[model samples]
Target: MTARRSTFTALVTLLTFAGILVAPQASAASLVEVTAFGDNPGGMRMHVYVPDSRPASPAMVVAMHGCGGSGPGFYSGSEFASLADRHGFIVIYPSAQQEAGFGKCFDTWSDAAKRRGGGSDPVSIVSMVTYAQQRYGGDPGRVFATGSSSGGMMTNEMLALYPDVFKAGAAFMGVPFGCFANAADYPPGASRCTGNGGANRTPQQWGDLVRQAYPGYTGTRPRMQLWHGTADTLVPYSLLREEIEQWTDVFGLSQTPTSTDTPRAGWNRSRYGDEVEAYSIQGAGHSLPSSGMAAAALEFFGITGTPDPDPPVPGTCSVKPTVNAWNNGLTASLAITNNGTATINMWSLAFTLASGQTITSGWNATYAPSTGQVTARNAGYNGTIPPGRSVDIGFQATHTGNAAAPSSFVLNSTACSTG
Candidate 1:
């Protein structure tokens, strides 16, 4: 055991310095291998990492791997085990059976896997968690789960089918639970599986699917964080919108975002109260962000704050608004510029609409219209504005007679000069 620990530490140090390890792969000598079977059908193999100085009941995180990826690959790629070392938690990387189908992916699209009871993939995962808690002294209350791609789809299944087992979950580049009911529904391309688009379903209808997955359990729903790359060709970006709607409906939260911010370049987060949040990674495609996500998910789970040490402060930046193109009194193209030295994490622009005019639809921001008052908050992708950088947000409106632009605008509570 001592020699294995020494070798693991050396491998990690080399990988960190080389900056080449990111993503899940087959097990390494460092991870402790264990098979979970006998009780659960279609059993799984788990590669677990325990920190050196764990508490009596340390937090446990179960991470699932994407198609063609191994538990160790995910463990090394996400550096989740490294996080466990720092945070004193246990990290489990569970592998799907190769017979499960394409690239050894979890059987998330099959009805058998979606069921809550025994013989299903979801229940098999629960069994693994139970083993961790019983054998390794894991805290039952602080269990969390996360995954990417097909594994992410499985993560969705776990959250919906076993909400009582997981306090929170995060899925990257994956669809909502029950998105695809069968293999035939999967897209032909490299894109991940997505079903129905949920376009025809009401919020209540979508929430009903989740409730039916568990059947008669009325415990607190698990919190969720969703991440997707906007430029991914495989999975449509619109799927992220559908997923947000599904979980928010389950939590009974409004569609409108409670807060929006760009924590870094290419990463925009829209938070819905505290129950659900979504991150849109700008210009990224089909993979997890190369850095920071593991720690970020842990921070979301209340495990540690190593990722975001400094909490966000309200911006004091100056905003300048410009009217790019105004349609025949009905539509307008507008742009806002950040003119402050510091990057603005979140921004909101407010202006009173002209009498008898109302906003209909908007882009690059969320528009909330009231009687003579209109507020637009940054959308997921445009929330972070670096110094001197600008983003465009536009809206279409209906007017009875003459259409006129609002005289002034306020951004983040500071008055903005109309350009």
Candidate 2:
């Protein structure tokens, strides 16, 4: 390990042993796992992070990851840990079912998952927040959810389904309001124009539905952060602009931003009274770079603006990326550090592997190989990583074709470019 990682490891070990005795002195941050109630027996696991002294300190952001993502990766790479510590707030990430093969993906268009209170979907997420409030002390006044791609689509669904619960939503690379209908109408792969099913709605129609969804909320239209990359290929870029115009038309937002600034990356930010904001990153692609956009979300959470100098990358989660030729497998261990400003209550990790490797695991968890990827389950380490602290995970794998250890790494939830 590098000097910095070693130091972080030592500090995290100390804090883990300290438990709740120290109380974090300043704004405390830790990751905890809570069970979200649904109709099913294995409900769903949610990773939560909160400040030391809560109730009214800072708000919370329900950070949702994209397709095949895990709560732990979101907590680690998004820079939420450091941001929570600095701004004195909380961040929560909930896992989606892997029955679809990918780890944490929302079945946004599933007919069975969308029935009124029938599916183990939206209700499950709301149950998670309620659990946080009851056990971890979450603020009801200011609660929100932000997501990327599929996760972002879920954010829109949350706004539509649980309008009374969430204060606002931040969507990045997500489809517009009624985009789900496209998938549902086509039953599989339906482009925007093709899906004219009864479920589908135009952008304006979605805005109208959202307006009616929240009847009593006479307050300023719920705060929101809209983000998109001009180069986003998965979710059409034009949809973002259209969503912004439609949302503003329905909500009556100011024509321009309250404050405009560029903290990092090529992202141009537009803020509105700490309630609403948007970022249009220039030349960016797909998901937010875990470091930049995640930190941006933290700032939007009203956390302090001290950026993590060396935030953990997705690649840093494991250590000693190695391949076992004898067993025809590849393996590595990972360390998760809390580089954000708050505490993480719980976390889970998920990643896809290139073809040729089938994971047979050895660590704190087991490996389930499917669709050219490995899903490892690690539990019971609810250790708190103070700002800039690190935690580690170890794994060993078996290879099929020409499998080799990963050349890249992630530490404490952030993504590293190289081994």
lDDT of 2 by residue, 297-349 (tens): 65554444655543443222323343445656555665555546654433334
TM-score of predicted structure 1: 0.65
lDDT of 2 at 41: 25
Model 2 TM-score is: 0.58
Clashes of 1: 8
After superposition, the stretches of candidate 2 with alpha carbons farther than 4 Å from their true spots are 1-30, 36-42, 51-58, 98-104, 111-119, 182-190, 193-203, 212-220, 254-265, 270-276, 305-419
Clashing pairs in 1: 22-77, 23-73, 23-77, 24-73, 24-74, 25-72, 25-73, 25-74
**C-alpha positional error of residue 51 in candidate 2 after TM-score superposition, expressed in Å:** 4.8
For candidate 2, give the lDDT: 0.58
lDDT of 2 at 357: 56
List, residue by residue over 1-419, the lDDT tens digit for candidate 1. Answer: 99998998898889879986533322423577665422566567777887776799999999988887788777766657766867789888888874544567777767777778746567677887887888778999999999988777787888998899999998888787877757656543523344234334566766888988988998999999999987665566777887788899999999999999987644799999999999997655565633567678888999986465233323443434333334444666666777767655445566777787777776777665433766666653465667777788877777766577665687745667676
Give the alpha-carbon lDDT of every model.
0.73, 0.58
